[model samples]
Target: MYQEITHSFTSKKSLLRTIQNDNIVYYWFSLLFLNKSLRATLSQNKNTALSYKEFIASLYFRFILVFFLALFASAMLFHVFSDIYWAVLLPVIALYLSAQKKGFKAFCNIFEEFINQNFDSDSLQKKTLYQIGEFYGDRYAIHSLVDTLQRNIKTYTYFFGISFVFLVFIYPINTLVTCLGLLTTVLIIRIYFNTFSLLRHLQNNK
Candidate 1:
């Protein structure tokens, strides 16, 4: 009887885990669909009100800022100062590691060298900025790291948090936190899907 009870308990636990994973899959599906839709909506105009280039650029900047703000808010709410400090560490480490990347750093150094040379060009964008952008692009590699970090953070933020909420029904404040956290995750997932759908369309066209 004890063994049977243990078996049943394990089975129930497995079911809950499956449900949680299903929730995550649904979230990704939402992201994929939404991204595609945005692509279509923006590209619909034969002569768009805004240039396509500007549209893309605007989306990029806006999403980046939104991501930054979300990160900021999470850290602030949790009082996780060290967590936010990753922003600083990322850049410094990227710069130091950049030195080993086969002259990429040297190419980038032209920017600093130019500033040191004190050229009489009135415009700052004269030339060094281009080299800087190129070298610095890979310096921190935030873009490359995002997929992994996002996977971990999203799971922790959504699935684990939800699980904890269900388990913590005894706590009063959990009701509020759980609701807010779940709602935020849902919204973010929806936005991600909208853009993802657009990306799919672009890929299909190519």
Candidate 2:
């Protein structure tokens, strides 16, 4: 009886870990696919389209490298301070900020290069407008596709964000981080919806 119970507990633990890992992968994949800059990077090479798998792998590798580095730093902090609050909280905030900074930097660099290369700003803007108009035209069911993409984006974002928030509660030192993280997640969701709303408004006016 004792052996059976232990085996059942171990099996359940393994299953939960598998589910968590799978959710993390799904969230990360959705993030890469939804991000405009990452998508643009894939299209950078006209002669040969960059392999999407490789691109995602490269970025994920960078993220994991940084994440582990942060963990090491957190461990060192805990060792020295002997306090969970300062050690864990500081590293957690630093990790979040570092990720945001790196991502934004990449986006800015790519967007700047794209603008500089396209010297004819007027033509570029006109072409973009034309494409947008066509996308929202009634000829096809593109809106359905857009709606589905937006829905999935929101769903994945919430799944990951809420999971993180739940994790924050597990660690007693995560009070401030949890509140701020939750707020940021809400802001991100709002921005995504707002972008879609703006696009639809343009479609209506056009």
Candidate 3:
């Protein structure tokens, strides 16, 4: 969920709020206003004709912004007990890796679905996907969006998994919190796999 930017130059309070609120305006506005060439290209490519370099740059920018914020918050919260702030970055690094991996898979799945539709008749699921594509401008945009989502979900699983291990190493006295983190990590992993399973089911149906 991203809040739209209202000004070319936003105040510090607004910037911090935007980050805390998960508002993309934090970095999106920077790309739109700071880089004239990229802005012009993006304006011309309104139909989601973003270049590969642009896509990677945008993803990294957003990821880096969130990573620092998470790192700061984790440090503040954990400073009372331990000084293992570096451990917070493990999940962030894993998130970048997983995003690239899952994002490619999602793009392939989406492309396969499009190809399947061409050779075979339109099924209910394919039609629904096409309709969903309308909101995303096209399949390319959908690929970007799906990739973002998959990476976020995977990162959450990574976060909980890391949290469980870190807590055990630093503050093993809190068994309840550690167990909850473990359960959350497992649950999210299951859901992540289910997303791919659903994609496969849709493709097979067609």
Candidate 4:
């Protein structure tokens, strides 16, 4: 009777664990796919007026999201599966690949739109500094800077919070690596943007 009770308890625990894992998987997929759908919708809206910072933020988010998604799918394919599980993963892999390809194309389209909107010298120059000053007085640049800062803070908070949770629960060593990688990425991006800005400034002077 003791053995029977112990066996029953173990089975119950296993079932609960399976249910919890399923819930987690469901939640993750829902969130990922929902974001993908929303991004797709936004990408289709070519008339959407986004500031330069917002455009950059959208591109950054999409790039990071796609990178992690692809990484997760690859890990599942190569590390998490046994030979027998390949059959189960085949459909998922196909779906993921298809979605990834479509997502990248959508991202490109949105990026192209942003470039056309922001880089067209004729249209951009039409809104001259004098016109901007008349319209927004002296506060335009300050407002833009404040908005960008707030957005950056929110992005940092979200990224750090998620990273912290994963670090504490799953990968403490990887968290350090991720932080270093993130810092490197930020520095590289900053340098790229600074260079781009310098080039634009020179062009405007000419």
Best by TM-score: 2
Candidate 2 vs 3: which has more TM-score: 2
Q: Candidate 2: lDDT over CA atoms?
A: 0.43
Alpha carbon lDDT of each predicted model? 0.40, 0.43, 0.42, 0.40
- The estimated TM-scores of all candidates read 0.30, 0.34, 0.26, 0.26
lDDT digits (tens) for residues 156-194 of candidate 1: 567646655664664546567867756766655544543
Model 2: residues >4 Å from true position, as ranges? Answer: 1-82, 115-119, 127-149, 153-206
Q: Model 3: per-residue lDDT, tens digit, 94-161?
A: 66557645543433333334334433343322333223324333423323333434465566657776
Give a tens-digit lDDT track for model 2, residues 1-206. Answer: 11211222122224234323433322322343334543554456542133444433334544454455456657766675445545566665576456544543443333334334433444444443223223323333334323344465667576666757575755545668777766766655543332333333334433
**Model 3, residue 164: C-alpha shift (Å):** 6.7
- The TM-score measured for candidate 1 stands at 0.30
Model 3 residue runs over 4 Å out of place are 1-58, 77-171, 183-206
Query: Global lDDT for candidate 4?
Result: 0.40
lDDT of candidate 1 at residue 182, scale 0 to 100: 63
Clash pairs, candidate 3, are none
Looking at model 3, which ten-residue stretch has the lowest summed lDDT? 23-32
